[model samples]
Target: MKYTTMEQLLLTELVGAQVINHGGIKVCLRRSENIPSMGGATFDHVALFVLDGTVVEWIDHLNPWDIKSITSLKGSETNLYGSRGAYGTVLIETK
Candidate 1:
């Protein structure tokens, strides 16, 4: 996997995204689209991807031991946790 760059995220407006804790991990959420198209989802997990550019805190949805990862959405292959047309969320935590 490739590490995300500050320029890519910042220029992409993926900063200050949100994240959710599932199975005790924090994962980055992305859009869900069968075809690679623009103007899709608002990114369900921006909070995790932009961690390198900024530090985020969702006290209500994370734990101290939580790790981080780019879990892709099933079928769609997008950087998300759950599946497309379903949850389309992810769970990454601190390793």
Candidate 2:
């Protein structure tokens, strides 16, 4: 839920939502923007966490449309994970 100033700016200023790459190393400012393939990686590839604490690599493969409902965590929000969360994290709650 916490984000850096830049991350917040991207979310508010961008015309569309943002997405992260497979390795969680890059952030796409707009939904239409394409993130290059990371060798078999799925689209919207960020660290995915469910309510149960299970983590997933990419949400696109599971269900492309599901990305819309995910809550993206970036910057300082990822501090808890140290290096693994350097890029960012995504939390998805399944109903």
Candidate 2 per-residue lDDT, tens place, 38-80, comes to: 3444445334343224655433334332233456666788787
Among the numbered candidates, top lDDT falls to: 2
lDDT of each: 0.33, 0.45
lDDT of 1 by residue, 1-95 (tens): 22244223222332332333332223343443532334333334333322323334332343333334423233454333232224332333344
The model with the greatest TM-score is 2
Candidate 2's C-alpha runs over 4 A off are 1-52, 61-69
Q: Each candidate's TM vs. the true structure?
A: 0.23, 0.41
Q: Candidate 1's error at 29, in angstroms?
A: 5.6
Q: Residue 12, candidate 1: how far off, in angstroms?
A: 11
Q: After superposition, which runs of candidate 1 have C-alpha atoms over 4 Å from their true positions?
A: 1-61, 70-87
Q: How well does candidate 1 match the true structure in TM-score terms?
A: 0.23
For every candidate structure, what is the RMSD over all alpha carbons to the true structure, in angstroms? 10.9, 9.8
